[model samples]
Every structure is written in C-alpha cells, then in structure tokens.
Target: MTLVDFATSSLSVLPAIIALGLAIITRRVLISLGLGIIFGALLLTDFSLLESGKYIFNTVKGVVIEDGGINTWNMSIVAFLVLLGMMTALLTLSGGTRAFANWALEHIKDKRGASYLAAFLGVFIFIDDYFNSLAVGSISRPVTDRFGVSRSKLAYILDSTAAPMCILMPVSSWGAYIMTIIGGILLSHGIADYSALGAYVRLIPMNFYALFTLLMVFAVIWFKLDIGLMKEHEINAEARLNESHKEDEDHVDLHDEFGVEESEHGKVSDLIFPITTLILATLFFMLYTGNQALSSSELPFSVLGAFENTDVGASLCYGALVGLMFSLITVFKQKLAPKLIGKALWIGARSMFGAIIILFFAWSIGSVIGDMKTGAYLSSLVQGNIGLHWLPVILFILSGLMAFSTGTSWGTFGIMLPIAGDMAAASDISLMLPVLSAVLAGSVFGDHCSPISDTTILSSTGARCKHIDHVATQLPYALSMAAVSSVGFIVLGFTASVLMSLAASFAVFSMVIAIMKMLSKR
Candidate 1:
C-alpha cells in the first residue's frame, strides 16, 4: 500500500544522520545505506510494519522497474558498469595492458611523473564525471602501479579532478545541465542583466572550492604533502614494491583490478585501440542523442543544445557496448581460445557486481531522502532571519551539509539554487552570482567527502582502492579546501568582490598547506 503523504519535518533528516554515523563507525557501506532506507521508510509509514516493508521493497523495485515499465536510465548505468568492467578484463587478457605498462614504465620514470600523468589525464577528460573517473584509471593505472603510487592517491586525484573539471569547463555535460538550470532561475527571478552563458562564466571565478580543489591536487603532488591516512598508504605501497624486488617488466600489480593472467602476444595497440574507440564513440553518441532531443524540442540544433538535452546514461551504455565489442575483437586476435574470453567477461562482470549493489542501495536511500523531503527540511532552517552579509558563507556551508547528507550534489543544486536566487533578489541583487556560485562550490566539496557519492564510489572502483580508504584519505584534503573556501565566501559576502575573496582564500590555503607540511615533517 502507498503510504500517506507527509509534510516536510525535522524527522526527514534523522535517517541520513543515523546512516552517516553508522557508516563512519562501521565502515560498512551497504549496512549504512540499508538501515538508512529502512529508517526513512519507517518514518514515511508512520511506524506501520507492513507499510514500511512495502515502502522499502517498492523503493528497491523502482530502481529497475517503475510505473510498470523498466527504468531505463538506472538500468543503463548498471549495464554500462558491467560492460566497462568486462572491457577492462578483455584488455588485461589481451596483454595490451601489460605492453602499455612496460612502455609507460620506460617513459614515466618515477612516482612523481606517474602521479602528475594521472592528475593531468583526470583533468583532460572533463566531458562527464563517470567517464572521467573510470577512463583515466584504466589508462593511468599501469604507470601509477609501476611507480609505487598508492591507489588511494590515485583515487583522490580522480575524485578531485572529475567533478571539478567538468563543472569548470563550460563545454562539458555538467556545464550544459547547470547552464539550463541557471537560465530558468534567471528568467523566473526577472533578472536579465546577463545571459545564462554569460552568468555561468561570471560564476566561474567565484567557484572557490572547485578552483582551490584543483590547485590542492597538483600542490599536494608537487610538495609531497601526503597527509592523514594517505601517508600510511603511500608508505605501504613503497614497502610492498621494495619487498617484491621484481623488475618492472616482470612485475604484476597486486593492486590492479585486472587479474595477473596476461597474454604473451599483447601489444600497446590492444589497449590504445579500444580506449580510443570508447572516447570517440561516446562523443558521437552524446551528440547524436542530444541532437535527437533538440530536433523534437524547442531548443536550437547546436552542440551545446545537444549536450544540454542528451541522455547521459543511455549514451554511456551505447559507448561502453561499442568499446566492449572492440575490446573483445582485440582479445580474439590473440587466439587464446573461446573459453578464456568468456572467462574474462565473467571476471569483469563479477568485479563490478559488488560496486553495482552498493550503487543500487545508494540510489534507494537517495529516493527515500527525496520522499521525506529531507532537503526541504534542511533548507527551511536557512530561511529564518539571518544577516545578509553572512548569506554566501552560510549558503555554502548549508549546501555542503545537504549534499553530504543526501549523497547527491545534483540534488543539492536543485534544492539550493532557487532559494539562493530568491534570497539574493530579496537582499542584495548584486550578490546573486556569488551566492549561486557558493552553492555549486559547496556541493562539489560535499560530494568529494560523501561515501555514498556516485563519483566517490566510481573513483574507488576505477582506482581499485577500498571505498573506506578513499574516503578516509581524501577527507583531510576536501575539508581543508572547504575551510579555505568558507573564508573566501565570507569575504565575498562582505565585499562582493570575487577577486578579493580568491586572493584572500589563496593566502589562507597557502598558509594551511605550509602548516600541514611542517606538521608532517615533525
């Protein structure tokens, strides 16, 4: 039975709070998410046992099947994960991965070079976060592994760059979607001083968290600033390398998600060909889907329009499928028998099964959170009387908390942006850009630290790092950047100057890093 509707209340947040606490204490993602969903369902059903059971059963069912029809978007994402995993397995068996690793080992030289290579690749792929998180990992893992770079470090670099770069680059899918939201927000508020594209550009510099987080990635690498749990991870990776004492060409990475059985006839092209196909094919499908959407809609037929209208999950599935076929062909060329290829496919699919399960529950918890109107309840706290000068920083922190609890940055954006716009219009209309930008910045910061965040999950999956390890190691970095950005927003709220705030924020970040460096040395 469908539960009765309820108004937004403080009870909406209890499930998330309990879930977050349990996740921290137990480090078991599924248990935390499942309990959270149950708690949310119980609250929705008003303590009725049968109704709560139905509420939860329906939530899980709805992910794959909703309204008596297959929920293709969620299913497509699941399919894409399995397809990508299988493709990765095929590449490993083809010996292409080994050949590429050997080749990269000769050129990449040291851990520093390997770290930078991963960082740059993560930044280079900005079209979409999921693609960025997984693609960069496959390409860089061999080199990073060869040089004893910790998987946690690789995960951090991936997580930091994926969303930050996508949000910063206006040509990206994220840019397209966010611009669409801004356009409507602009029109609804009767503000026509700048076009949506123009306003997005203006908010770029004001996105302190995104800008600073990017800086922190490279800075940490360059300065050898391995703080918190990351330090222990790096040390362990180094010790493992020393203990193995194997030559680069002979070494098999224990940390690699792909198993150690590699073909003897594999070449670098085996790796290069399939990956190139995936990138090119995904781009083609993105445009195709976007154009198809624009053709039937009121929007003009342009690249931006297509991106803004694209079905991302479907595009990822089609591209991954094409890439999988190509990778299979590479494996077939090796002529290593049909059984092994089938074996590789099974192994690949199995590897992703655990992650996919976590993703399903995470999505369910998100759905539960939505039904409870948790975001609305949290946002209501901010709508009370407050000083105008503190709004930007307050909004930034609130958005971060909301995203952190909900495990969805996009959801935070949907709830907070309109409130920020309305507040800006009511207070100081000139502060509109700063306030809106804070929501974007804070959401990314929260997403970085959130265990249930999709990007966080995918980054660990790509890096083959344990999920808790990634979260634990990256927390210090995200928190530091957030601290710096917090003060910057405070400056912006008072002065209304993006330049001054950035200048002030940079000074604070520099000092914080220096202090961290000294502490690490001690």
Candidate 2:
C-alpha cells in the first residue's frame, strides 16, 4: 500500500505505532501516548493543525459523552481501576496485605511453593486483569522474595495471567468488551444467535496462549527454573540473604520495597474480611448488572438504575466506604472516628492517581484508533489476502507484537478485537475460537516483554529489583511459551480440536522446558 493509501485506510494506526516506539525507547508511556494521539489526529485530518486540534477535542468529547457521559462502557475501565486502587490502599492501610504476605510466607516457605501460590492467586482473581495485576503484585511480592523468586518472574506471572485468564473468563470486563465486538462482527456476516460471549467460554480451554502461559507459570514454580534477568535477581537475593545470615544482625529486615513489614497485632481475619467482602460485592454487582434482574422491580430508585449510574468513581467510593467501615468495626472498633476514616479514604484515592493517569492516556489512544477507523482499515486490508486458516496465527503474533511495543494489553485488545472479529467472519472461521485466542495471546505476549508496561514496572517495584533487570530475566521465559503456543496454533488450525491441540501444546512445552533446564545446567 502507498503511504497515502495506508494512512487513509487506518490513519490512527500510524500514530499508535509511533507512540509505541517512543514509549519503548524512552520508557515514558504517557508522553508516548500523547504523541500518538496527536499523530493519529494529524493523520486523520491530513496534517491540518487546526483540523487536528478539532479532531482531538471531538475524540475526547466522544469518549467522555458516550453512554451517558462518564457512565459509558468505555470509561467503565477507569472506574474499575480507581476502585482497585482504593481497595488496595485500604488493604494496605489496614495492614491486611502485610498480614496476608506474612501468612503466605509462613505457609509456602519454599521457592517452588511460593511460585505456585503466586500463579494460583493469579488464576483465582481472573475476574479482571487490572485487579489481578495490582493485587497479585502487591500481595505476592513478599512471599516470592522470601523464596528467592526473581521480581521479573513475579511480574511475568502477574502480566501473563492478568489479561489471558480474564479474557478467557466470560464474567470479566475483558469478556464483555470482546464479546460486544465479536457480536457486531457476527451480525455483519448475517449470523443470528451467534453469541460472542458463548464463543469465548467454549474457546477458553482451547486458547493456546492462555493454556501454555498458565502451564509455564506452574512449570516455573515447580522446576524453580531461573534464567535471564530472573536468574540474576534470584542470585542477588540469595547472596543478600546469605550475607545477612553471616552478619547475624539482631534486627535484620528481609523486606524489600515491594513488601510490607508484618505488624504484630495484625490478624488473618483482617485480611479475610475485606477481601471476601470485595469479592462478594464485585460478584453481586456483576451478576446484578449482567442479568438485568434488578430492573424488573420498580422501586423508587431501581437497583439496576443505581448500578447503571455507578461509574468508577462511584465504585471506588463504595469500596472505600466499605473498607473504611470494615476497618473501623473489625480492626479499630469505635476508636476509628469519621475524620480518621475520611483521611484513610483520601489517602487510598490519592495512591491510585498514577495508575489513573496511565489509564486515561491509554484510553485516549485507543479511542483515537477506534474513531479514525485505523483498526478496521487494517483489518480489511489483511482480510483480502490471508485465508482463515493462517489468519489466527498471524493475528496472534501481530497482537503480541503490538502489545509488547505498547505495554498495554487493553490497548492491544481494543485495537485488534474489531479487526480480528471482522477477519474471522470474512474467512468463515469459527469466530470465537481463533480470534479470541489471538487477542488473548497477543496481549499477554506484549505485557510479558514490554519495558514500559505498568505490570512490568510494578513487578520490578514489587520485587525490589531494577525494572530492566526483571524484563531481561523474564523475556526468555515468555518467548519460550509464545513459541510453544505458536506451534500449538499451527497444529490446531489443521486439526480443529481443543483437547487435541492443548495436549500437543503441553507436550511441546514440556520438551522445551526440559531442554532449557539441561542447557542452563551446563
């Protein structure tokens, strides 16, 4: 395609690509995305500075005003993230996280067990990728450190399972978003009763990346296989632990930046109560919203209306209130007054500002891409040439590369979902199986290796290791899984059986792991 042809087909895509490159090189995600938005606007508006400015304003307004302004589905993510931050803050302030970490350390003492626990928790929190990333990183970092697991490995586990697992789960926000896109594609192709939601549930078992990555996580935990930057972090942590032992300091602190020092008065009940409440509340809300049962009764203010009106702000407000109340009633009793609780709530909200800002920019870039039809144009171009048989693998790799470069799986999914869905329909592919798998796999792959990815930064932050250190160590492991997954896709494309494909993929992964272990020993 000529430059003009390419630009017209997907003008927003150029800016995103440029922004990703800038972010990777400079490690400044927000700045890169800002530039990307600008570039996308410029491309769509034909470099007319005045027109680009208008496009930018309209893009922002369009995103903000959709679905009752801030209450729209696009902004639901922002709300979810803000609530996650507040919840995390409350947990931190209550010493619940510290208590859990200490308990985890005591229970899963070995490196292998620690790794397994981290991966296990990741699977457990498959409701949302953002929550999974932040929660797992915050809660499991300390336990992993105690076992000499590298920070990068922790990040890898968190990032790998974050999007992959959630994308597979039908109840998650990721599922809702992808299904909507898939449904639209199905409708366009004259298919009726084709539920994108149903398709995702069926394809989960067959999703090569999700299956392989989960297996890889378990393998890492079980084998205690350390390579790349992870190896370096483990060696360093081991040396530090050894030296501390030799010195025999009376008050030696093993806690790193990512860990919380256990409070003497903290109890397991403190951790269990808030977490259980959070999970129950989230599930209740999701079911209530998804099923529309709350709308049937005409109360003064219907429950469904309240939920529909609820934004991230409302959710966080609710979570903060609940957390504060729980903290006072259970942890502090009457000693916790309104002022103290208010302060804690404010602290919790403020703590998530960084993440909120990142989410905003990520959303902005994605909005630009969607508005300018970059993804659709690209999808059309690709559809004309590639057969359905090979499209899945190509899209998987493409999604992975895009996510890796951008360091945002949500952004990657946002860009690829429509395109992949359209292609699946055009090529007569099983709309849900290959396309969903490709999006899920690609997103994890990108999050796995991207230096600027928030999860990567958090992993490094949690591990108390250098960020680059974590990325270098974890890249090899992620690549290995991706390779195995690619082969699995190739085999599945021809054979088209979930069980058979997964079985073959697992075998290949096992063999690869064995070879890597043998080579590492030498």
Candidate 3:
C-alpha cells in the first residue's frame, strides 16, 4: 500500500489540478478538497469505482484518526484553536476588549493614528497568527470605527500583520513549525553542517515579501493612501457614521459577532493579563520542551538551541492549555457566572469549527499529495533549469502560485522547503538561503492575497467586513508588495548580498508608495 512506489505519473498531479480548478470555479474549499481526495483515492484504486468508494472512506479515516497519519499534529492544532477560542470568548464576555479599545481611544486621536495603532497591536501579538488576527480586530475595530476607518481597512491591517510578523519572529508558533520542516529537509538532503535555526536566521533578512508587506502597512497609514474599493468603503463608512442618530455611535454591529457594547464591569487588565500570560507561557514551554528533547539527545543546551530541538506541537498545546487556565481564573475573578463563562467558551470553540474542518481537509489532501510525490514531480520539472541568477525569484513565483492555489501557506512550506533544500545540496548555502527565504516570503504573499485562506477568512470575520470586500480592497496592496518583493528576490539571486538586496527592495517599496500616494490624489 505504499502509493509513492506505485503512483502513475499521469494521474499524480491530476488531483491537485482538479482541486485548484474546483476551488477557483466553485469557491468552496471543503467541496474542492473533498473531491480532490475522492479523485486521488480513485486513482489509487486503479479507477475501480466500488473499491474507490471504500478506499476513500478508509483513507479519510486513517488520515484523521489512525496512527501514522496527520492525527498527532492536526489534533495539536485543534487543541490550540479551541483553547485560543475560549480565551477570546472569555475576554469578550468580561468586556476586556471593549475596555482596551476605550483606553486606546483616549490617545489615538485620528483615523491615521487609529490605523497605526491597529497595525502596532497586530505586530505586538506575534506568538500566533490566529491570535493576532482575532485580537487585533476585536480590540481595535471599535476604536477604528470611532475615527471612520472602514472595516475593510481594519481587516487589511489585521490580515497583513498576522502572518508576516509571525514568520518574522523566531519565537512565534509559525517560526517553530517552519523551522521543524526546514530542519527535516536539511537532514534528509544530507546537509549536516547547517542547523535549522541557523538557516532560518540567515533567511530572515532576505524575506523581502514580509518586510515589504509590513512597510506597506505603515506607508498606507502615514500617507492615507486609500485606493480602489478601499476608497469607496472608507467614504461609505464615513457617510454612515455622519448620518447616525446617536451622538456616541458605539452601537455599530456590522456583523453578528463584531462591535462592542461598553460594560461597567470590564477592566483593561482582563485583556492584558491573559495575553501576557499566553506569550510568557508559550515561550517558557517552548524552551522547556526543547530542553527535555535536547537532554535525551546529549546536545548542548541553550535557550536558542532548545528552540531548535523543541517539539513545536507539544509546546503549543501546553502553552494554550495553560493560557486557557489563566484566562478562566481571570474571568472567575471578575465574578462572571460559571454558566456564562462555560457558554462563552463553547461559543468560541464553535466559532473555530469551520477553521478546524478546513484544516482537516487540508491535511487529508496533503496526505494524498505526499503519496503521489507531487512536489518531487514538480521539482523534477525544474531540476537543472533554474540558474543561480534566477533561482530566488523563480522559487518565489512557484511558492506564490502554490499557496495562492491551495490557500495554505503552511502547505506551501511543507511542499517547497524540501525541494529548495535538495536544490541547495547540489549548490551552495548562499543560493539555498535566499531561495528558501523566497519560498517563505512568497507563501505569505499568496496567503495574504488568497480569498480562501484561513487567515483571510478569520480577519474578515473578526473585522465584520464583507469577506469579498476585504479581498477586493486588500488585493491592490498585497500585489504591490509582492511586485516589490519579486524585484528584491531577483536582486538577491544575482548579487547574493543580503544588504544590497534589502536596500534595493526598500528603495522599490518607497518608490511604489510614492507612486500610490500620487495616484490616490489624482
């Protein structure tokens, strides 16, 4: 039953193609992924319809629950999601988010300041992308609304910062997950000299897309450069606010779960304490897990070294569980009814149900892709065609397409890193680092733009913006940064100097922002 040994070359890529085609045409990720899995199962069963049906049933079962599947990692994600959800809900019920917004409103005076504050808060919460998106939107949405900042804009700030910041911060969940994959790839390709953390650190400066994307947020805020559908949305939001009957205008429920109702019992500490605890616990557990693993391996133990050796899934689960406990204690101290807390926790977990289902299907499809060796097949197509001068940009473009099509940057990372590592084994470290950085940057770029992406969905939901509106308004900004990042990657491919590439990229970003500002005025 080792499908990789028996997979037909012709049918290997068909499932992925079908899945992408269906996603674009139908705009339903669950259905597209399900169909992809069924088609892949059929191919595995040699087109025997009856056996294919049975195989589909068994495959999904194994992928989700049985040993040697994605169950271990997938369940860790699930636990993290549920715990984070409960924390958000507890904060909401205690009115900590509203209180924080009110406190923030005292200092953040205008629309521009509000936008910058949102961006700052988004960047501040970098432990987890999901937490960043939800926390930024929930806390800053009210303040942004007070200053006539559109929901679309809020969503943009949240979405833009979430992944980019996480990918940039080595202490983040994203960093740990990606490093694990990269480490495996390096070991598998026989690159024994380089450690995963070392490689990741080297790739950081060359992460043009993330750096440019973060800069774009600041530029957009500072220059007030609203264009395309964003301009229309902002104008419309202002109009609605002006015509409001209430002078305070705090009762805006743009969506079911958004908007804040001020509560006298709410305290800013309620919000601050849980988040602080979450961060501390996450970092602590990461080191703790790393130390445990390292002790067994007889490796020299340092905090940074521990991170390189840590079990990311286990650490995340442990941190989330502890964070949940702290949040519950805070909520109980606020004298909220036990039943109400329980209800809020359930509601929060329920809210994550859709994300969990998408993750499940994503993992299932990944299993199929692994068996088919789809990434290897794609790697075969480019074996020696990519010259050193073009490798970085080419990898960027390929990773971008893959992530955009699949709507999962993590999946893109899983697929592309090994190929990049294998390429590196045949080449040099200078080439490998930049190419891997390109892959990481491009993955975030595509995820930032893809409407079907989980972060995109969560951001829109959190901001109470129309999902399509969020995508349409944010596309221009994302594409602009992507264009700049591409140029930077190209420069790096040729020069192999990180400093030169970064300077060139920043120059491009500045020029593009100036152009955008000029266009906005016209």
Candidate 4:
C-alpha cells in the first residue's frame, strides 16, 4: 500500500514480464527464465552495480544450497525426470515403444484414439503434475505421431492436465505446498469458521479451472480441433505419412533398415522392475511426508523429523541408481556386455540435461521473487478493496496474472495462498473455499500460458516441437478455460453452493464452446 511497497512490487514484476516477452519472441524458455532471475536480483539489489553480483549469487546459492538446497524437492523432481529419461531410453533401445506403437496402430489406429489416450494418461497421472507431463509426453509421442496427432496438440494435452490435475489431488506436492501457505494465513487471522484442509478438499471438485481444463483436454481429443500451430503439425504429419507410403520398396526397405538398426527391446522384467520400484518409492515418500506412520516411530528424531530429512531428491536418486543397477543385472543375466548399461545411463542423462537446466532456472526465479516480496506487496494492495463475497474471483484473477507473468505456479501459490487466506479471514469468508480455489485456479492459469513455465517448456521439449508454436496454439484453450472459471467464481460468490456452482459452470462452458464452434464454421 505504501508507495515504496508498490514501486518494489511493480519493479519485481518487470523482470519476469520481460523474460516472458523475450521467451515469446525468441522461443527460448530457459534463457528467458534466467534473464528474469537476473533482472529480479538486480532490482532487489536496487540496481547497485556493486551489489547486483552478490545478490544474484546469493539468490542462486539460496536456491541451490541453503536450507537443504534445491536438492531437496527439486532434486527429487530431477531424479524422477532422470528415471523417466532412462526408462524412455531403455524403451527406445529395446524397441518397446515401437512395439507399443505397432500394437496401438493395429488397434485404435487413428488420431482420435491417440489423442484420447494422451489425455487419459494425463488424467491418470494425477498424483504429480511433473510426473504427468514427462510421462505422458515421453510415452505418447510416438503413438500420437503414428496417428497423425500434432506435437503442439500433444504438448497442449500434456501441459493442460499437469498442474491442474495435481492441484486437485490432496496427496500431491502441490497440495502440501498450498496447505502450508493456507495454514499460515489461518493462524494469522484467528478466524477458524472453516477447516483450511477440509475446504481445499471440498473445493477441488468444484474448481472451475481444474475441471474445465480436464474437459478441454477431452474436448480436444473428441473434436480433433486443429487451429494455429496444431494445424501446421497436422499438415506436416500427413505429408510425411504420404511420402513414406509412396517411396519405392527398395528405398523404403533401406530407410527402414537404418531406422530398425537403432531399435532395441528389453525383456518384460526389465520394464516391470524399475516402474515398480519408482511407484513404491513414491508411495513411501508420500506416506512419510503425510505423517501416516508417525505414531509407530520412537526414535530420538520424531517421525516428522525423519520424514523431513528424507530428501525427495535423494530418494529419487537412490531409486534411479537402483533402477540402473537392476537394468544392468537384467542385461548381464541375458549375457549382454555391461557396456550397454553405460550407454543407457549416458543417453538418459543426456536426455535430461534440458529439463535439469529448466528446473534450475525455475527455482532461481522463484527464489528471486521470494527475496523481493512481490507476492506480499501485491496482496497488500488488494486486501481491503476486494469485498469478502467477491474475493475469490478477484484473488483468482490476481493469482492468475501473477503466475502468468512470473511463469511459475509454485511461486504464484506461495505468494497468493497466504494473502488470499488473510483477505478471506478478514472479510469473514471461509478461508478454505476462496483462498484454496484462488491458489489452484491462479496457478493453473499461469502455468497454462506463461511462456517461461517449466511444464510449458517441457511439453514443447518432449514433443520435439517449437516452444512458441506450442504456446501460440495452446493460448486459446487456456483462455477459454480461464473465462469459464471466472464466470464460475462469480456465480459461487453469490450462491456458495458447490453443486449449483459446478453445474452452472459446466453449462456456461459448453454453451461458450458451442457458440465458438458454430461461429468458426460460419
């Protein structure tokens, strides 16, 4: 509210916005995010040339080292990503992907089915958005291409379902982060009419952005809607398929021989073991984090302490190591040289380099935003002006804008959750309903469109497609969902009835989509 605070907040946002603009124009997400971090650090240091270098170093160090370092949860993400890459490499080496693609081609054999499968996988991996994006992209890309689905469309499906689905799942990392922020807000306000945890659980079913995104994913699959970059991909795929078909038998066989030479297939056990280890490890991690087994432990350290100390990154790293070892054992048992295992590991690590760089930049940017107090400053400006009844919708929009501008959903939730919770408490609104919903909606909306968003970048990277092409093609879908969510919140503000809010939202969304389709045809 103070001029200084307003100026600082405004200044903090500039770097992120510039980064986004640069990303949009250049189609380089990591570089854009890195620039945003540098800008934020410089701004936070008051543009003092002498202090700017220190500020940037501190920012990076704080994220990568201090307080258990970026190796904590981020490392866990990297571990999973590395594991995914290894799995993908192994599948690729073993020709499992080709086999699966051939199997899919024999069955569904169409673009519609491929799209639906991709969407369904997105929904199925609801436990974590990071996992969903990587897994869906890696697994479905081949089949989708075989069926003529565009890489942009594939990216859209992967990005659409990632954060939105994770936000709705109570047991995921996204839920834990939101809950911590909400708990802080509730404790500060001394208003306890609604249970912060329970409310978020209830609101998940009614979150218009989350639900609408899922719907749009399905709609895209069902309708095979091709617009913008998606249309370009479609044209390319069709042309490639046609060209492949028209090639002379000898020429085609020669090309196929070269391609087939690179393909390898693993035994069934090779596939099952690593995935099983990953699932069990993830479940154990979740249970530990959730404190499900706290009462059973009587060690010097409390169960919570033990859980906290159990680094997700460390766990994942261990798991990946185990997976690599298992893969080697399998290969050796089959009398294959151990050198092949090294190649698999090298290929997996190589594939994950881009993801690792993006993750690092995302974390650095988040740290810069935290140091600048951007969220707190923004929250102060809107605290009293937005009424209790209208806070949800308003905060939803604010969170969305912040997230979109910063291109970081975690940063958006971290900043907005406390502020929204405080505002809701002060206005006599239920802390859970407005605060949690706003955080969820805002995070999803931001991730949906922010050119610097990691998932956005990964979605493009996974599809091997152009980044801006994906952003341009997916913008309309994200906005349509946002518009529907905005109307849903407005209705909820008046009625506060979950069923009615959701029904009205779905109805309105369907009507809008129908109208748009009709207009397009005309």
Q: Which pairs, if any, clash in model 3?
A: none
- Looking at model 2, residue 107 earns an lDDT score of 83
Candidate with best TM-score = 1
Residue 124 displacement in candidate 3 (angstroms): 2.9
- Model 3: lDDT of residue 338: 74
Please write out the lDDT profile of model 1 over residues 64-95, one tens digit for every residue: 99889999978987998999988888888899
lDDT of the candidates, in the order given? 0.87, 0.63, 0.77, 0.67
Each prediction's total of clashing residue pairs, residues at least 3 apart in sequence or on different chains, is 0, 6, 0, 5
C-alpha RMSD by candidate, in order: 2.5, 5.8, 4.2, 4.9
lDDT of 2: 0.63
lDDT, candidate 2, 443-508, per-residue tens: 778677776566565554433344555566777878888888887777667667767777888888
TM-score for each prediction? 0.96, 0.77, 0.83, 0.85
| Sliding window of 10 residues with minimal summed lDDT for model 1 | 246-255
Residues 12-68 of candidate 3: C-alpha lDDT, one tens digit per residue? 677777876686567576788888888887777677888777766766686568765
Model 4 lDDT on a 0 to 1 scale: 0.67
TM-score of 1: 0.96
